[model samples]
Target: MSSDVLVCQGISKSYGEGEQKEQVLSRVDLTFQKGQASVLIGPSGSGKTTLLSILGCLLAPSEGELIINSEAVNFKDKSSLTEVRRLKLGFIFQHAQLLPFLTIKENLVVFARNTGMQADDIEQRIQLLIERLQLVAMAPKFPSQLSGGQRQRVAIARALLHRPSIVLADEPTAALDWHNGQTVVELLLDQARVEQAVLVVVTHDVRMLPLFDRILAIENGIVQVKQNVK
Candidate 1:
């Protein structure tokens, strides 16, 4: 472990106002160091996903400050938040969310291209990710041709292709069976360690707990840390 990659101080989130108000998260503080992988688990509607979203910079916290790479980000500024997300963070959702019209390899490259990356550099990164994620054989295939596990693997590859310093995965294996779900999580954990990325995953699957360096439980908007099989 090295310097803290992400830090949240007194983070809180709420929705609506007055009679329609909904409080999803209470004051929460967290720190994640490089190469650390954490799994956040909670019951349905327990605000685990909300916390994940705040951490990923997808949703601004109703209150508190977020420091990324030792700098406090102003979520109120869309451009600042967008730039931080683009340069430092990677996100994975429950669904693979691959582009149906493109080949597996193209799906990965298209995203890099959108960032105006050099064509040769993009190709090199794609091949590297494909090999690391063991997606070489499936590169030529389309999303529809892949199994659920395969697609999720590709999603993992796509999220990491940019070599992000922080990765936020929200229920990434929720769509797969036991075998495949475990496989996908294992791959994510392994890859995060290899890249020395700060990975935070939100999931209800307790089976994936042992693989994480730490586990956090959320309930009634409160966050509790649990020491795991690190």
Candidate 2:
């Protein structure tokens, strides 16, 4: 069996129509292996987020085929695409994007609930993930009560709550200071590896670039492999 977790071939995307149409991505081919951390670096408006969205099933490419863990996914149907996203992908945004009214525990459980997981085991898995992510003490706190780093940590725990096969992160460390940013990166790398999932991070920070297994650069709507220093 192939070890590829994500496979994209000749993917293309555009927005608008007619003469106003703008191509955001063009023929982007990529593949990510299980347990590997792939970092995508690019300038603003360079289609890094566009490509990530496509890979995460948030957006459909104009023409291409994507195979996730050997299963073909049609990005055309809205309902089916939503189901695929819920069942197969975990997303971590720049901000934690937690509900201010919900506690950390509630956020995690809510994720499990939406994924059709057993309600009886929600607490067990939530606690386990909180402990694993070193957020056990903050489980009872809401997003407003925690620091930026703590909130991001909770977000990561929530993302992993349902045990998705792939985690897609967008500027995960953009909101933190030096120490906290490094800490978050390390935590993400460790948990992603431990869970045996493919991690694709879209980041502008070069500080954390060395830690990734592979680095790809996006420019002019194209993605090219860059040398990994570490």
For every model in order, what is the number of clashing pairs? 0, 0
lDDT for 100 (candidate 2): 90
Q: What is the lDDT for 10 in model 1?
A: 95
For all predicted structures, in order, the TM-scores are 0.95, 0.96
lDDT (Cα atoms) of all candidates against the true structure: 0.89, 0.88
Against the true structure, whose TM-score is highest?
2
Q: After superposition, how far is residue 119 of candidate 1 from its true place, in Å?
A: 2.8
Score residue 69 of candidate 2 by CA lDDT. Answer: 81
* Candidate 1 lDDT, 111-216, residue by residue in tens: 8776566899899989888898889999999999999999999998877878889999989998999999999999999988988999999988888899999988
**Candidate 2 Cα lDDT to native:** 0.88
TM-score, predicted candidate 2 vs. hidden true structure: 0.96
Candidate 2 per-residue C-alpha lDDT over 1-230 given as tens digits, one digit per residue, 9 for 90 to 100 = 88898999899999999999999989988888888899999999999999999998888899888889898788768898889889889989999899899988888888889999997778788878888888888988889999999988987887777888899999988999989988998899898999888999988889889999999899979999876766
